[model samples]
Target: MSHRPRTAEAIWQAADLPARRLAGVALNPTAGTDVLLGLLACDSAAVRMTLCRDRDLPEEVVNAVLTHPDHRTRSFFAANPHIDPAQRARLVDDAHWLVRARLAQGPGFSHGRSELPEHTVVRILTTYDREHLDTLYRQVPRSARWTFPSHPEPKVRAFACDWWSELTPRERSALLADPDEEVREHALRNGRDLDPEYVERVLPDRACHARTHLLMHGALSRRVVEQVLAAPVGREDLAMIAGNPSLPLDVLALLARDPDPQVRETVAGRPELTAEQRRALATDTDSAVRTRISVHPALTEEERAAIDYRVSSDETFGRFDIPARMYDPARSRHYALSGHPLLRRRAAHDPGLPPDLVARLSCDADPGVRVLLAQNHPQAPAELLLDSFLAYTGRERWSLTTRPNFPTEDLAGYAGAADPMVRRLALLSPQTPPGTVAQLSADPDPDVRADAARHPRLSPRRLVELLDDEELAHEAAANPALPPPVLDRLVAALDG
Candidate 1:
């Protein structure tokens, strides 16, 4: 067999080692644009990595890589220092944490650099992190150290306390007396080496959540607890101490008999309470505390079930966690017909709700409940969707139009609706017939015309006509209907 030099495309797809290595290393800007585009789609990670560093790579090319299915590739694109801040912001909510992490390194709002303003640095650090925290800590401005101790996340606050000596006396005192209980708890645990002077100042403050946090830390002295109880403090503060697991039996007994019902309620829910304590609380005059004791784990299973039951409803729904059992066929039906509007509203939104219940709620007297049925009931009757369309406006109307499996044929009239947004969405529907798209191609609203220009069914000549329109050209370029010859001419025009 006669040997001839293989073309770049042949080597780009070659099975041989030397040929593929040459393909990646030798690839450069001078290569044909189509060849570069083809190589950009190569299966090899090495080739992709090599292409990202090319000096002549255009911003348009980098933006195109953002849509690559491989997260690593998208992340590489995001980490490019030159990546536009606006482009980088698009990846912040990406599903993969690594992609967001890469975007964080860019110049925009990630506080990625050490040189950003201190307030901006402090604001960005409030969100939790794993990899970025330690690196960011060394770079954090000394002036910004005061704010982290009261940060919403306990871990971040704890991290800040690791360098406690750097904070001023006022900062230390403020952290100790912080209103958020978790921040105070972290301070007591992590600020052990700090001067006791701050603690002395925090101890005298009447309303600080720090007292209960100190109780949690086993650092509260008997004298301090006594002083707090005697201080003419509000019952809410007393209730917090009453709930403390490490509280002494003597103080617990005193609080158990406290005149305040909230204090009694707090003590009733204490996990460390003995069976004897629970039994004592069971007889309390407060019915709410009695109910708490019935369900308390300190009572035996039989004892818990033995309590006198009431048919009346609890004003505050317990937990409201909406467990899986709430979705059971029988339970959902019961809730759907209940007199309580909230229960009926919840049932109206339940996906597994019985079809008959869906029909009932569709015409619910409460418009909010009816809207819930309209949004969530997948099997909603056509008349209900139509009525929902006519009955609602603004977001509710827009929301109804976007429902999955929406009969697009029903949207045909909306193409000319008074609301331009409604008309745009109607025109964008996959089921919008060809004739409607053709008609909207000349829509007076530029936005509607832009959407029509990008429609996959748009004719090739119409796409060519949009080529010179800067607003629609990019979208028109993305239309797969454009012929290769047209793409050649478009590229030629751009180069000229």
Candidate 2:
């Protein structure tokens, strides 16, 4: 039974249609620059959000957004992940502080590659007031920090002074005497507060995390240590104190035998652990304590294997989804070949794995190993990414599709696959036919149907029918194939 397509008048007369039509058009990949430019004047918050934030804009549209009257519209573009970071970086000096802050925060989802230009970062650090500067500082990648101390920008060099404790003495001295007043001030500010006398004077009055910071990184005097040991701190604080490098050998031994398994676990990783302490912790009653000791640098492989440590197959790897710091290739290589799947999984977290190891791990029997590799490695094989996407339903599942090597060609074959999720992949393929897309628009699965509804190739007759469909109207309206006459009518009806 064939039905005639809805008239533009009928769609215009439909109840509550304007917002949906505008939203859909905003997402329509085929929406021309002129259509988008018309939309920019529509003054609907929902329309503005969808238009500015949801997809990459044309150069003309991007320019429109850059100078958009509404701050929210500009702010949304600042955080739009689909655009190049350079586009987002341009907003660093925007008139609105909120827009600049959004740019500082980077994209909402951390694929781990988005970063502001170094010049922009320097400008924000130098010119932004303290509150906004703090926001930018937190988003700065740890890998880039190494260059900060030597950067030509004084503000960047001053930024490195925040990690005063980690700097070499030579670096510290140089920064303290830096020609830039701000850089020298920052070095002095961080260095002065960590002195033993300053720590001792402030130890008793400091809060828990503040005290923990002093204990862990600040210069700790005997009085401060004694004060901390006598305080009624919780297990977390005790665990933190156990890992303090400045702790005396006697204190380290005492903490290794602490009743709390967590504190013992913390003490087990200490470099100062005596041979006897290591042996005792290896046989600790708690499995986690034993596992911690098993990886201690002092232990021989034979000794490490001798300990009955546990590695759960159900262990979550969410933290390892994105590489946070520079990984050591030597250590990653060693772990990649280890007998334990947990060790192999750890190795997969390294994004810079050698090609050979990447190939070897791609075939690992453990699902975690393959998924982690797919998530972390830049050159993860396309087949592995597709396989991982199909097999894993974790929160980060959709991220697989965004990977550089994820296959986009010849995916129409998945349209008829039994799994609805796999069917969705067909819509991703440019080669998928309009007939197949229309068929999927009526698919049993709502997700598959929704994806099909937005597909650019969907037939115009069905697209108009979907605009009147409550379930698919928003998606159908978003279809790039929605005719120019229909789009013009929908925009014209906006005032009514």
Which structure among the candidates has the greatest TM-score? Answer: 2
Candidate of highest lDDT: 2
Residue-level lDDT tens digits of model 1 in 104-199: 554333222323344434444555265644444533555556667666665556567666667677766766777767667756656752334444
What would the per-residue lDDT of candidate 2 be over residues 32-57, giving only the tens digit for each residue? 78878888878666677778877888
> What ranges in model 2 sit over 4 Å off?
1-16, 109-113, 138-157, 177-185, 192-194, 204-207, 319-325, 390-393, 407-449, 456-461, 469-471, 481-496
What lDDT would candidate 1 get against the real structure?
0.59
- What's the TM-score of each model vs. the native? 0.41, 0.81
Q: Which ten residues in a row have the lowest lDDT in candidate 1?
A: 312-321
Give the residue spans of candidate 1 off by over 4 A: 1-73, 76-331, 339-342, 381-383, 394-399, 428-435, 442-447, 487-496
10 residues in a row with least lDDT, candidate 2: 2-11
**Please, what is the whole-model Cα lDDT of each candidate in the order they appear?**
0.59, 0.80
**Cα shift from native, residue 323, model 2 (Å):** 6.8
